[model samples]
Target: MAKISAAEVNKLRKATGAGMMDCKKALVEAEGDFDSAIEILRKKGQKVAAKRADRDSSEGAAIAVVNADANKGVVISLNCETDFVAKNDDFVALANDFAQLALNCTSKEELLAADYKGITVEEKL
Candidate 1:
């Protein structure tokens, strides 16, 4: 097996916001290949999302943003499984970011299709 460095694990953790151990395990499973490790982590997130599909996402934050020109406005909601998660500062900030992204789009389809950081907004969900 290839050696996994702490730097590589930290890089993955920073990029994905996954737990440290989860990032390490992904790196180990990918045999130290960075991109493969990222893919593994993304797949794991997909599994978690699938498992949470039945969850009730009744708690969330709503945010609105106006374009620089002030002619267009958009509102977005980010839902979570629990009230604690909904109230988290990070969660609110993320919702605001989504709203900002939405301000530039014409339709819900376009907003979901928008690129966020690296992946599509839908993928981020």
Candidate 2:
């Protein structure tokens, strides 16, 4: 197997938002191919998600919505690092959108991939 370089690992880490070690391992697994390493990290993220099923995600905000014209309503909350940040416009917007997508978010993993504003949930984080 070809040895991976640190610069290559860092590039993968930056592109995928994965941990340093994970990027390095993926690079090694993919034989230092950048694209393959990204795919490997993505798959690993899915595996990790299943393992985190039992973890608590009680720190997010709860948002509620009401569609008066349609006689429908919805509510959702997005967890974040702090209340102050939670109340910010961007955070509030995310929480609202997540709440609106609550019915569609089949799992935590799916929620992470769902688009919020212009970016994915992971990128927002």
Candidate 3:
């Protein structure tokens, strides 16, 4: 195995927001290749997501928003695995943004397909 330095691990951590240990392990597994390490980390996230797919996500926030005209309104629910995460400021902000997006959507499918920033609403979640 090639030597993986602390600098490389830190770099990957900053780029991916993954844990220090996870980044180091990925760098080692990828033989110090940054891109491959990112792919490895992303795959790990996917695996974890798949494993948790069946878990209940009953804790979250419901948000409602009205357009400037006051004639249009939208409401949405964003679910999370834990109350700690559900109450996070970023989580609430994202729910609000989704509600705002919902005002423009004609259906659930359109809401999911709508763009949030640069990514789709489904992808953002």
Best by lDDT: 1
Error of 3 at 44 (Å): 3.1
Q: Write the per-residue lDDT of candidate 1 for residues 20-73, one digit (tens) a residue.
A: 999999999999999999999999999999999998899999888788888888
Tens-place lDDT per residue, model 3, 1-125, is 98998999999998777899999999999998999998899789878878999999999999988999999998899999999999899889989999988998999999999998776787556
TM-score of each: 0.91, 0.55, 0.71
Supply every candidate's count of residue pairs whose N, Cα or C atoms clash at under 3 angstroms.
Answer: 0, 10, 0
- lDDT by candidate, in order shown: 0.91, 0.75, 0.90
Candidate rank order under lDDT: 1, 3, 2
On a 0 to 100 scale, what is the lDDT of residue 90 in model 1?
A: 81
Please give the range of 10 consecutive residues that has the lowest summed lDDT in model 2: 74-83
Give the total clashing residue pairs for model 2: 10
* TM-score between candidate 1 and the true structure: 0.91
lDDT tens readout by residue for model 2, 59-100: 657777766475666666566555677678866776777767
Clash pairs of candidate 3?
none
For model 1, name the residue pairs that clash. none
TM-score of 2: 0.55
